[model samples]
Target: MATINVRRDVKDSFYRYKMPRLLSKVEGKGNGIKTVVPNMTEIARALSRPPSYPTKYFGCELGAQVKCDDKNERYIVNGEHDAERLQTILDGFISKFVLCASCRNPETDIIIKNDDILMDCKACGAQNMADMRHKLSTYIVKNPPAQASKNQRKQRKAATAQTNELGGGFENEEGGSDDDIISQRINKEAAGLSMESKLAQEDWSEDTSEAAVAQRMRELSVKGVAAFAEDDDEGGESKYELFGAWLDEQDNNTISDDDIIAKAEELDVYGKYKACQVLVQCIFDESIAAQIPKRANLLRKFVTEEKHQKAALGGLERLVGLEYKDALMKKVPGILMKLYDVEIIEDDVFIKWGEKPSKKYVAKDVSKAVKKAAQPFLEWIENASEEEDSD
Candidate 1:
């Protein structure tokens, strides 16, 4: 009945996400021996994934047959695998399937679109593609999760309720009359709250409107993120272009990170997220993998948020995928490893980047080529993460 962190890579004792420890028992003898997982249902419940997924994953990884007797609530894998080894394999399943590629949160729903498998994260709103090259992906596509239907029903119910609220009516989508008395009672209770109490419950400081965000940006004044502000007004685009021009003029051999910061501040684009993209594209060339360690501190300074990390990745995509495709494309994996080693980019960010191609920085085909070249490093990152968890 022991529990372990759902994300084995996360060693925090107080981690909120957890799953029941995998329990394996070997049954039969000789060629008839098989490993039975008595608690797989419980484990899958905790992970919000179908129990069949991990079972099939075990089969695929170990090159053994897996059997599931759902009515009897039993799952088994061929061969006499021990609990310790099975646990390590389970960690790999969790990393590839359950955890979000962007936030590493275990709260995700499996979504299949066309030939692609995607993990839609509830924590960070990032939709990450699963590694379809894995043998389990084909199985997952053939047998979608049962919860998908329930999720669709929930969405429909929420939509109907929202329509009722906005239209000031108690009727549902099917033209059926809702409970008039209950609706009146709910309205009466809502009307009973004092305006002062409502005002007290509201937190004005957390305003995320455009005006508020613009005001904050103005007050902060080009620390290093102004170039990547969410605003895309003509003035903002002009400032970004000017910053890019200035960055193109700097010599990578002589210009220090401090000098870059000073110029960014002078140009009033220091704190913008897009500034990271421009800097990365202009600062590094074919020798980017080798130069990353030397300029890792500068990257750390700019990549303060997820969006900034995304911009930096976009820059790399442009550099390797577009500008120097022949020279640097083959080295994409090593380049990414260097970025990871120096902490210039995080595992989640790069993993998400490698899962799919984006055309925001480079051509769609070029973006795909870049990600294709990075597959080896991406697999290494996932494998290394699982191995770390085993320790």
Candidate 2:
């Protein structure tokens, strides 16, 4: 029933992507002993890959024969194997097949072209060719999935619909001349425009009051700010300023997480980590431990990269380690566990962070003390990894 980060390398307990833990049951004995992955289909669904891919990957890695019965939803690898060993091999499959080389997100679709395998990332829109040196590429090329046929059918249907809509303009039941039909269409459009012009002239009005003028100016100013904020080329300045002004206008009351996420989307701040930096400062108080879980959705929406993840974690470090040091010291591990559960920080990121004092988040001494406080959780993760390796 336990779940782990989809990207096994990511140790964050709070990571948004997760998969059911690898489960294996050893069957038979002696030369006939084999490992059956009871939840191969479920894990493959979580990774957005076919169950056979990982099963074959295990076979290739372990030098054993494998059987993948798609109809019966059973995956078996020859020879005795433990869950921990198979789980480790699964990570290799994930790195080669699922994760995008360019953006590192696991949202990728495999493409086979010119006898080569390509990975197309849906998140960052990058195309990367799978290394042909891997044995799995040959299998994938030979046994391609059915997604391509479905996509082609959808495309053909869409093209037919578009052609029909455009073809409607030139239909001639009575076999009229092309020139005559064109002229008739032009005349009809001209008449409609003329009617619209007359209606516009009749509806014209002007408000000359000073109040109306002031209101119009305010509306225009707001519109200009919104336009600037939504312009992606303008960087985060406009978004930060606009969000700052909104926060300032809220008086002393806290803003709702939904409102914050909505505003971030409206301002086109989704991909920019700087917006996350600004959000952390404005949204949380001294007691960030209690607020982290509540605001996890917003964090997940914005923090997709290592930089953004580190930035958000750094913000939390400053909030808890500096402002509420005395109150949160004893609760540091629990707070970190919550962050991990929500996937705010990965294992490597958190472990590397706790290993040394970095001025990136706070003063040298404060960071050192914070990392020291997090030692217990770090040790627990290390111990777990050791146990898995021993198994």
Candidate 3:
């Protein structure tokens, strides 16, 4: 994960929302979150850009520019300092001189003077740039980009495999994107169009062709999804305005049946595993299966999946059978037990080195992921509670 760099708009945007995400990976997930308070001098250097220096200055003097010195200047981004905010800001970056691996604390007494890096840690005193460089470089080298992911791993493997690979992106087949068009043309001819498209061929537009079809139901009403989904199971019709609002059906809150089938066929674009939860949840009626593709058709035709298997089954849990229920339920118990009803845990938390323990009960962020994953089950339990009350 690349660290988030300086971006002013940190309001409701991703910077604020995903900060905890980044924080969790480094501190929350990795080795129980080693919180290194960034050395203050490095923090200041990072938040405020380093003063630009001349080109030749790079060999001997450029080092001085980034290092804390009379010339290096303490961080006063837009002219103020709140060390915590500065910390959150730096969470967005991958590489910069501001990062120090030996010491993670931002408030470290180590500040670079004109000729050297001086440490406040009792064991290490002042050290020259060459020494700091050697130490920091070793750590950086060992760190393996600090944010390796599956994509990065694959790219790394591919890079090593081929000598002709350029700039470390993926190797590709020659025909470019047009190959997709040719393949699709053959697929369309090979697989005949169903009644829905044959009937509504004139109404369909070319604009949303590239739009991901699986997510269409999330935008539509359940009733609409079902009506469009069921071929033989039809009565009421839907005024489906492709990218439109939830249909206004006067009789019921549940969406119309037509939209369900339309949305179900849309499921064909993605793999079954990826589409199942969303497709299951968005389905309003089962009768529309006659018109929809395979899984949606299966759902439309069968509704007796009645083993109370709806536990974490998205919205359409009532219709999906025991096999799905058994598989899904097994995974939920441990996650629920791990995160649910747990107010606090006694793992080490980062407070200022000498700043005394904060009330341990107050830091709720440590358990956020477990709580987030637990949300649907929590809602299910609440709904069950309501039903029990009504009973």
Candidate 4:
């Protein structure tokens, strides 16, 4: 009944994430030899993934047949296998499907969108598309988890109910029904020889005097200003414009960090972590290694959660992956170490980024090279983690 961290890469004994150790029993004999996982359901529940996913993954890895009996809750892999070997294979499934690509958290749910499978992290709110190159992805796409289907149905029902509530009611008239009022208004509008009236009205134009024109222009100006003010009150200044202007002012040393924070609040960009995105975009140009400490204060102020951290990292990735690929390919470890030293990014975040080279944020070749450059740091962290585990 011993439990271990869901992510074996994490060596913290007090790590919040855990699952029961893999248990297996060899069954049958000779030609009919197989392995049975008695507690697969319990392990799957702890990992927040379907039992079939791991069961099928084992088969794919071992080049054997597998059977998943949902009705009986029995998962069997053909050919005799030991618990230790199966557990190693299970780690592959955990990394590919259960763990969040951004935060490396196990609180993830699989979703199907447009026939593509995606892993959505409840912890970080990152939607990462599953690598379709894997055989298990095809299985997941064709046979999605039942919980996702139920949630989709629930969402559809809630949306339909909201639509009904918004469009259901009719305004009550004081004297008559809405239909009667509409009918009367239409009749009055159409009354009294419309063709003759139209001909007469064509010849009778309104005043075109300079005074009249000036008065009309004044009225329009007043209304336009009032409408603009109302819109400003509701939506505030455009966030992009405000952030851009603040960045320009900062380059000229006309504004302090306090000034920018206050302006972000006024622009309604502080609470949602939009300021962190802007700060990343503006503070670091082609090189972020030396600027990590300089912008650490801003990152700490705004990047409070995994989502915000991921967004800031995303901006950095764009800066390096697009414009400074050579620099990233050379100094990835130094840049990552600087970010880690400043506590701007977490170990898991960097580890996950280094483990998988994502084309979503950078070119495939660039992502690969960047990740390759980060191997030394990644290996150091892994060794450090093992040392921690030993202690």
Estimate every model's Cα lDDT from 0 to 1: 0.77, 0.71, 0.30, 0.69
Residue range 1-391, candidate 3, lDDT tens digits: 1234233332313221121122111112222222222133332333322222111112132132122222322211222223344344344331223223342212123344554544332111223232445334333233312233467446534533332222223323321122333444444554565655676767655445446454564446444544454322242223222212222122223444445544434432122222333334333233312213323223322221221112113322222222233433334433332322221111111111112322221233322322344456556545544555566
Please state the error at residue 68 of candidate 3 in Å.
28
lDDT of 4 by residue, 1-391 (tens): 4699887866656454679888775643446567778668879988867889899999989999999976546688999898889999999999898877776767678899998988886654789987889998899998898675677546545533332333423433221122433444444566656866888868667789999999888557544433353332254335544565557567623445667667566555663544565667666765577767766655655665566666666666666667677656578778778877765665556666667777755677866776787789889876765565566
Q: lDDT score, residue 295, model 1?
A: 88
Candidate 3: which stretches are off by over 4 Å? 1-134, 141-323, 326-331, 334-391
Q: Which order, best to worst by lDDT?
A: 1, 2, 4, 3
- For each candidate, give its TM-score against the true structure: 0.41, 0.43, 0.20, 0.38
Give the per-residue lDDT digits (tens) of candidate 1, residues 29-50: 4465677786788899888888
Q: Candidate 3, overall lDDT? A: 0.30
- Candidate 1's C-alpha runs over 4 A off are 1-235, 389-391
The model with the greatest lDDT is 1
Ranking by TM-score: 2, 1, 4, 3
Residue 147 lDDT in candidate 3: 31
Residue 322's lDDT within candidate 4 is: 72
Q: In terms of TM-score, how similar is model 2 to the real structure? A: 0.43
Query: Which candidate number maximizes TM-score?
Result: 2
Error of 1 at 263 (Å): 1.3
